[model samples]
Target: MNGVIVGVRKDSQTYVNMKRKACAEVGIMSFDVDLPEDVPEADLITKVYQLNSDPDVHSILVQLPLPKHINEENALGAISIDKDVDGFHPLNIGKLAMKGREPLFLPCTPKKWHKDKGAKSSCSRSVRRSNIVGLPVSLLLLKADATVTTVHCHTKNPEAIIKEADIIIAAAGQACMIKGDWIKPGAAVIDERSQRPEQEIRIPIEASKVAGFITPVPDGVGPMIVAMLLRNTLDGAKWVIGQ
Candidate 1:
């Protein structure tokens, strides 16, 4: 199996390295394309097109948080849905949202949480409107028969909405934003923030006392995301080979 990873920023490079390492361990040939932060959007799309046509490249992943100038939607849309290992392609997400239509691959972080069928019994998504995490996750929850309420930055009385959820997915990227009092007692909290010293704790310590289950920022969703990425790559390769 073969996969191509394209990344620009320093932090994205770190994630790329982790994926490359995982690919190696799984015996998948991985290729890297490191562009400057200021690389032109057209050039990036051109590269994606090149990979889309490469028979050997079964999966293509564009590391996210592209430079402010680059259009994230355009970049993600350029990827062939068949080769979109990150599952960020609009078509894939569209299929994921519709009933009886399965996406080729689900967004990895949400897919990880989706594995827990129990969590899907009832869920709430705390996220900004984005392709990466919030919307896709809410769709998945809806499919699983969970009533999902998406609480974003602009949502009024976000805490009151959050406190009613049985499961809370914290993907808002704000540190300590989901306070202990915001959680419903015994609610499952999945924190999807990237780990940083200042933001080591995504959900505050007091949250753990009230939350029945809470995932740690550093050790929780990050590793699962990489694993899901690899799984998606393998699945993409299998589909190509008629497996």
Candidate 2:
């Protein structure tokens, strides 16, 4: 898949080498770009769209951590939904949130005029973490075919929202964000980065008593998302190839 790696011009050498070396071993095409000069957010998006619209190009990835001045949200919005292998397109995000209840435009056809095309899904809800570490929870629930709700460091009334979820995923990078007291008592809780610094750490509260099928802090949901990205890429390639 041809892709333009935006935002990291000179520093992109390492990642390009890495992608080539890694994908070459498996005989998969690794496409890219390296925006060496610091550019405006719109310019970065324009470059990505140029490559994204190319029929020969199947995927587009803007290497993230773009320069501090660039607007990341807008640049990310530029990628076409069908080729959103990184899974950041708003259209793809909306489609995922719908859980197949709504129609997003497939690559072959125009669909979904405005945001109001679908019925409500058995929607996912969010949990609160005290810190900036709850980022990976969405990646975990994406595997369960559940959308992630955002109740993070800045959110208020975290306790009340935790009760609404069919699933609860917590990775606040804190010791424990959701105690057994805060949960719905039977929802699934996945801790994606529980064992990052150490293999064993005590949870602040006993969630297994309240939650159903709680993931272990060490080996639960972390590896699954890694596998999910690989599976998505492999699965998506067949569709791009019309197989």
Candidate 3:
């Protein structure tokens, strides 16, 4: 598998490192295109187009939280949908929302929540509304006939909402914001928020004793993200060779 990553933030360096480690472990060839924070949107789009045309590149990932000057939609649009390993392309998400139409790939993080982990019921709560994770997971749960409640900044009594969910997905990016008491006993929990090491350890350690299953910050959905990227790259490579 071969892929290219475009990023701007110093924090994004960690993602690059993570991806590299994952690629190395799986024997996937990787390439990176790190741009300055001040890079023009057009230049970023151009870079994506160039990688899109490269025969050796099976997947293209443009890291999120791009500089203000760069329009994320334009940058992501420049990538070939077939090579959208991150699965953030509009078409991929659109297909995910439509019944009976399979997306080329599911967004890595959200896709992991499809299975209910020994929860007492299929009632689920999503703490975000982004196209990437929250909405997709909610839609997938709806498709699976699970009762889904989506919480956002405007939601009243978010804790009470959480208490009703048999499956809880915290992707709001607030580190350790969700507590053990917020979780129903025996509930399945997926926390995708990352905080500092000390703070990150708190949620899992606390929630594990309450929730039926808790995904630790590092070993949980994090590794699955890299695995999914490789999987999508392999799928893109297969499509390229008409296999």
* Candidate 3 residue pairs that clash: none
Candidate 3 per-residue C-alpha lDDT over 1-243 given as tens digits, one digit per residue, 9 for 90 to 100: 688878787777887888878887888888878888888888888788888888888998888878777777888878899899888888988888888988887787776555434323489998888877888888777777778899987888888889888888887756666667888999878776542243444254677888887776666677777777778888888988995
As a whole number from 0 to 100, the lDDT of residue 3 in candidate 1 is: 95
Per-residue lDDT of 1-243 in model 1, one digit per residue for the tens? Answer: 999999987677777898899999989999999999989999999999999999999999999878899999999999999999899888998899999999999999889888875544676655555678888988998998898888878898787888888888777766777788888888888877743343555688788888888886456777889999999998998999995
Task: Report the candidate with higher lDDT, 1 versus 3.
Answer: 1
Candidate 2 residue-wise lDDT, 21-117, digit = tens: 5445555566656565666666677787787678766556566556777776787778776555566665664554454443122211011101111
Candidate 2 local Cα displacement, residue 225, angstroms: 3.0
Query: Which of 2 and 3 is ahead in TM-score?
Result: 3
* Clash list (residue pairs), candidate 2: 5-33, 9-35, 9-36
Say which prediction, candidate 1 or candidate 2, comes out ahead on TM-score.
1
Candidate 1 Cα errors over 4 Å, as ranges: 119-123, 194-200
Error of 3 at 143 (Å): 2.1
- Report model 3's TM-score to 2 decimal places: 0.89
Q: For candidate 2, give the lDDT of residue 229.
A: 34
In what order do the candidates fall by TM-score, top score first? 1, 3, 2
